[model samples]
Target: MQRRTRQQLRISLLIVAIAAGLGAVFGLAIAGAGDGDGETRAYARAALRGVWTGGLIAGLLTAWEYIYVNRPAGLWVRRLTFLGNVGVRSLIYLAAIMLSIWSGATVFSIEGADPFGWNAQTVIQVGFSVLFSIGVNFAMAINGLLGQAVFLNFLTGRYHRPVVENRVLLFADLVGSTAIAERIGDLGFHGFLNDVYRDLSAPVIELGGVIHKYVGDEMIVSWPDTAAGRSRALQCGIEFHALLAAAEARYKNTHGAAPALRIGIHAGPVVIGEMGDVRQEIVFLGDAMNTASRLVDMCRTLGRPLLVSEALRDAEPSEDGPALEPMGETGVRGKTRPVAVYAPAP
Candidate 1:
C-alpha cells in the first residue's frame, strides 16, 4: 500500500516538472524577442530569468518532497530523508540565485549602472531577495515534513515503549500442561489455554501492567516502579488464580481434570528498551526477570498454585487489594541466602 502511494506521487511529480519546464522555455523565448527599449528589455529579461529559475527550483523541490515523504521503512528513515532534502534544496536555491544575478548583470551593463550607484549593490540586492524567497519556502517544507513524520509515527503504533523499568514481573503457566495435552486432544487443550490467557490478561492491563510475552500457556507481564510493579504483580496472581478456578469449575462439570495454573511474582529494577535491528523487540532485562522465572520453578516444587517474594509482599498495594499469605523462606538456586515467600489468598 505504501509502495503504491509513493509510485503514484513520483509519476505525478515527474509530469508536473516536465510541464513547468516547457512553460519556462516559452516565456524565455517571448522575453528575448521584445522591442528595443534598453531599460524595458533589461527589466523584462531580469523578470523572465527570475521566473524561470523560480519555476525550476519549485519543480525540483516538489520531486524531492515526493521521495522524502513517500519512501521509507520507518520514521527514522524519513527523518534522515528530510535532512538530506534540506541540504539538496539549499544547494538548488543557491544555484538559482547565482543564475538570477548573472542574468541581471548581463542585461544591464555594470559600468553604466555604477555611474548611478546601482552596480554591485543592485546585483547583491536582487540575489538576496531571490535567495530569501527560496529560503522561506524551504523552511516551510522542512517544518511540514518533520511534523508529518511525528504524526504518522504516533498513529502507526510504532512509538509504544519496548520495556518498562521498576516493574513487578509475573510469570504463569498451566500445571502439567504436557499431561493434559496427552489426555485431551491438542486442539481442545489449546482452546483451554487460550481461554485462561484471555481472562488472565484483562486485569493485568487494567492495573497498569504491560503484557510482555506469552510462552505456550505461560505469560509474562510487568508493572512500572517497584511498588506498583509488585502490587500489580500480586493482583495478577490473585486474579489469575480466580480465573483458573472458574475454568476448573466448568471443566469438572464436563468430566475433565481441573486445569491448574502456577504463578510467580517478583519486584525489582529491570532494564526496559527497544532491541533489534531488522525486527525490533521490547524486552525486560535484569536480576528481576531471572528471579521471577526462578520463582515460577519454586511454585512447581512447593506444589503452590501461586508464589510471591518478600520484596513483592512488602510493597504497598492499593486499598482493598487482595491479601497475601506468608509462605516462609526458602533457598533457591543462585541465591546465597533464603528469600521470604508468600502466596495470594484463594
Candidate 2:
C-alpha cells in the first residue's frame, strides 16, 4: 500500500484502540460509583457497553474524517475561515455524540429508561463524551501544528537528551524564487510559496521523510540512515521533480509562472536534541546538515537540478535505479577538502 494510505490506516486503528480502552476504564468507574446492587453484573455489562460504544463512535468519526471531512482538499467547509471550520466541526461532533449516546443506551439499557431524559446519569455520560472529544480534538490540532515526528518525539521524550544518530537529509530549494516573487507581488508570492509547499508535502510524506524546516524557499527533509531511507531519499528527489512538473500547468495558470526545484541529498551522523526555553524545539547539529546545505548551494553553481554526495550514492547503489554520473571533485564553501558529487542521469 502507498505510505500515505498506510499512515491513515495506522492512525485509524490507534484511535479505535485508545477509545475502546478509555471507554472500558470509564465504564468500570461509573459502575463502581452506582448503588451496591448486582455490582459484579453491572460492572461487566457497563464495561462491554462502553467498549462497543467507544469503538462504534471512534470508527464512525475516523471514517468521517478520512472520507469526507479531512479528505484531499476536503469539503467546502474546509475552505472556510479557521474559526468557521472549527464551529462547523464542533456542531457535527456534538450531534454525533448525542446520537451515539442515545443509540448505545437503547441497545444496552435493561430498564428501558428514556434516553432523552436529562437525569444525572445521562448528564454525566454526555459531559464525559464532550470532554473526551474536546481533548482529542485539541491533541489533533497540536499534532497538526507540530509535525508528526516532532510531536511524537516530544510526547515520548525521545530527544530530551542529546543523541547521535545517522540520518539522510534532503534539501530542496525553489529555483528562480526571487524572480517569481518579483513577477508576482509580495502577497501573491506568499500564496505561491504556500501552494508550492503544499504540493511538495505529498512526496515527502509518501517517502516517510520528516520535514526538518523551511529556510526561505528551501525545504529540508530528513530520514533515518537505513537502506530503505537512502533509497527513499533518492526516490523522493525524483518524485519531487515529477510532482512539480505535474503541477506546472496549475502554477502557470494561477501565477503566470511554473516552479522548479534543485535538490541535494547527503547522509551522516548528527547530534539531535530539544533546545530553547520559551521557544523550544528539536534541533539537529552536525556536519551532515552543513554538507547537505553546501550540496544544495553547489547545485546552482554546477547547474544541476539534483545533486547527491558520494556518501549517499555509495550507500544505496541500486542496479534498477537511475544511474549517477560523476561531476568530479569540487571544493564547497566551508569544507577544506573537495567533496565528490554526482548527478542523477536524466
Candidate 3:
C-alpha cells in the first residue's frame, strides 16, 4: 500500500511540474505573438495567461485522478478503474471542464482583463461535476475488482488451499511397493511414482475430484458431494485398474513381476484442510478416511486389488467404474453393524 501511495504521489508531483511548465510555455508564446508590440503584446500576454491558467488547472485535475485511481483503495471506487481507470476519469473531467469553459466563454462573453474571461460559476460547476463523477466511478470500480480478484486467484492456483467437507473418500496404495522400489532403485522409483500420479490425476480432475495427498506409495483423493464423490471414487478404481494393466505390460518388458496395487474406497463425510506448517498440504479427517484406510488394509486379507462399499455401488451402478461383485457383509472395527463389501472387477 505504501509503495503504491508513494508511486502515486511521485506521479502527481511530476504532473504538477509538467502543468506548470506547459503554462509557462503558453505564457511565453502569447508574449512573443506580436513581435513585442505594446497592444498586440498585451493581448498576446493576456491570452497566454488565460489559456495557461485553464490548462494548468485542467492538468492538475487530471493528475489527481491519475494518482487517486491507481491507489489500492481506488479499486472500490466505481468511477475509477484500476490504473486504467485513472486515465478514464481524467479524460471525463478534462472533457467536462473544457466544455464548461468553452460554453461560458462563448455564451456569457464575460470579458475580463484578458480575451478569455475567468467565470467562477463555470469553474465551480465543472469542478463539482468532475469530483462527483470520480467519486461514483471509484466506488463501483473497487467493488467489482474485489470479486474479480477472488475468482482470478482461484483459477490461477493462488488459492489452492482445500476446504474440508463431509464426503466419500478413497485411499489407493501400491502393493509390493517396497520390493518394486528396490528393483527400480530410488531415482527410477520416484519417476515411476510420478508417472502413476500423472496418469491418475486426469480422471480425478475430469470428475471434479481433488487429489488430497500422497502417502509414500499411497494416494488419498476426495470428491465434493456424496453422489458425484462416489462416482469419482469408483471411476478412480476403474482407471487405476486399466492404467495398472498398461503399466504392467511395460514393466514386464523392462523389469520382472508387474507391481500390484490395492485400492479401498469408503463413503462418508470427512474434514479437509491444508495440513503441515512448512508446506501446506490438503488432508482429510474423520472415520470415512480411516475406514478407507482399513478397507485397503483388508485388501491383504481378501487378496484383491480393489474394494468398495454398497453405498458407492448403489449411488451410480451403471456409471464408469470397475465391474464389481458383492463380497458379503463383514464386521469392521469401528462400526457395530456389518458392512457390505464389493470387489472391483479385474
Candidate 4:
C-alpha cells in the first residue's frame, strides 16, 4: 500500500480505538448510576453497546473526512469561511450522531425498551453526543492549525524545557523565488507557494520528517539524528525533487511557472524547547540549522540542486543509496571552519 494510504488507515484505527475506549468507560459509569437488579449483566451489556456505537461513529466520521474533507479536490469545502465551515460540519456531525444513536438503540435495546422513545434518558444521551461531537470538531481544528508534530509535542509536554538532541536538518529553498514573485505579483506568489508547499508536504510526512517551519519560500525539515533518520532525509530530498518534477506541467498550466527546490542537509545537536507566552511555539536552536541554511545558499554558486554536508554523508549508509560526488570544502558565513559538502552524482 502507498505510504499515505497506510498513514490514513493507521490514524483511522487509532481514532476508533480511542473513541471505543472512552465510550466503554462512560457506559460503565452510566450503568453504575442506575438501580438495576442485574447490575453486573447490565454493566457488561452497556459497555459492549458503547464499544459498538463509538467505533461505528468514529469509523464513519473518519471515512468521510479522509474521502472528502481532507483531499485537495475539496477546495470548495476548504474555501468556506470559518463560521461557514463550522456550521456545515456541525450539521453533518449532528446527523451522524443521530444516526449512530438510532442504530445503537435498535441493535442493543432491551425487550421492554422503546427504541423510538422520547424520554429524559434519550434527551440526555443525544445532548451528550452533540457536545462530544463539538469537542471533537474543536480538537480537529486545533490539530489542523498546529502541525501534527507540534500539536502532539504540546500535548505530551515533550519540549517544555530545553534539551540538546541530535537531529538531521534539511533546508529546502525555492529556486528563483524572487523572480517568480516579481513576475506574478504578491497575491499570485502566495497562492503559488501554497501549492508548492502542499506538494512538498507528502514527501516529508512519508519519510518521517517533521516540518519545523516555512520561512518565506524556504521550508525547514528535521529528523532524528540516527542512521535511519539520515537515510530517510536523503530519500526525502530525492522524492521531493521527483514530486516537483511530476507536478511541473500542472504548475506551469496553473501559474505560468513550475517551482524547483535547492536542498541542503546537515546533522548535529540542537536545543529543542517550547517558547513564547500567549502564542507558544516549539523552537530548534543550534549551529546545524544555520549551517544547513548557508549550504542551501551555496547551492546557487555550486549549481547543484541538492547538497549534503560531509557530516550527513558520512552518517548515512551509502550502500543502497545514491552515490555522492565530493564538492571540495567551502567556507560558509558565520563559521570559522570551511565545511566539506557533496552533491548527489548525476
Winner by lDDT: 4
Winner by TM-score between candidate 4 and candidate 1 = 4
lDDT of 4 by residue, 1-346 (tens): 8667798899999999998897788767766777764666777877877787788888888887887787777667666766676666777887877787677677776433435458866788878877877776666666666776677789899999899999999999999999999999999999999999888887787778988998899999999988889888888888889899999999999998899999999999999999999989989898998999998998999999999998777544346667888999999899999999998887
Query: What's the C-alpha lDDT at position 30 in model 2?
Result: 71
RMSD, candidate 2, Å: 2.8
Backbone collision tally, model 3:
18
Better of 2 and 3 by lDDT: 2
**Model 1 residue 260 lDDT?**
77
The pairs that clash in candidate 4 are: none
Show model 1 residue runs off by greater than 4 Å. 1-164, 251-257, 316-323
lDDT agreement with native, every candidate:
0.63, 0.81, 0.64, 0.83
Q: Model 2, 5-48: lDDT tens per residue? A: 88989999998999888777876777777774666676777787
Counted clashes in each candidate structure: 2, 0, 18, 0
Residues forming the 10-long window of minimal summed lDDT in candidate 1: 108-117
Which whole-number lDDT from 0 to 100 does residue 211 have in model 1? Answer: 72
TM-score of each model, paired residue for residue:
0.49, 0.88, 0.50, 0.89
Q: Please state the error at residue 70 of candidate 1 in Å.
A: 34
